[model samples]
Target: MTLTKPQDLSTEAIATLIGKNARVYTTGDMLTQDFVPNRVNIELSDTREIVRVWLG
Candidate 1:
């Protein structure tokens, strides 16, 4: 649940570390089908945020 920890670097592992209460966002390239996440925003006492943009 604590994000400031060094061991919590991997964003994908957040689901297991915090359980279903956490929020996860995933995106992919339209042509390549390659998944990528650009930025992550976290609100106070709220779940995490993931912002993905396709640079076409």
Candidate 2:
């Protein structure tokens, strides 16, 4: 993933955008019981139709 130039955007906006795709740990989220509200796990694989798993 590519990042934009953070020139005038606030930290909150940046963190929110990042949290949209990945996890973000902050003072408020970490302090409360909703630190990890969602799971951002991803499974990327190469284009292959093998019996098991084929990667290049």
Candidate 3:
């Protein structure tokens, strides 16, 4: 949930760290409105690079 230099981390790395609780996608990807308290959302760039990370 808490990562240092998260931008330096890859989506797969995050998935490995967070397990099944993570949702990795790009900025223009469609996402559901329903929020899961324990889920982690990872947003990526157009180039498929990680841009942001948050808890939902």
Among the numbered candidates, top TM-score falls to: 3
For model 2, the superposed segments whose C-alpha errors exceed 4 Å read: 1-7, 20-56
The lDDT leader among the candidates is: 3
Candidate 3, 9: how far from true, in Å?
9.4
Error of 1 at 3 (Å): 12
| Tens-place lDDT digits, model 1, residues 1-56 | 75553333244565456443333333332233433353332222122233432221
Question: Candidate 3 residues 1-56, lDDT tens each?
Answer: 76554355465777788785788888999999999978889888876667888898
Q: What is the lDDT of residue 16 in candidate 2?
A: 71
Q: Rate the local accuracy (lDDT) of all candidates.
A: 0.35, 0.33, 0.78
Number of backbone-clashing residue pairs for each candidate, in the order shown: 0, 0, 0
Write down the lDDT that model 2 would get: 0.33
List where candidate 3 sits over 4 angstroms from the true fold: 1-13
Give the range of the ten consecutive residues with the poorest summed lDDT in model 1: 39-48
| Rank by lDDT (best first) | 3, 1, 2
Measured by TM-score, how close is model 1 to the native structure? Answer: 0.22
Q: 2 or 3, which is superior by TM-score?
A: 3
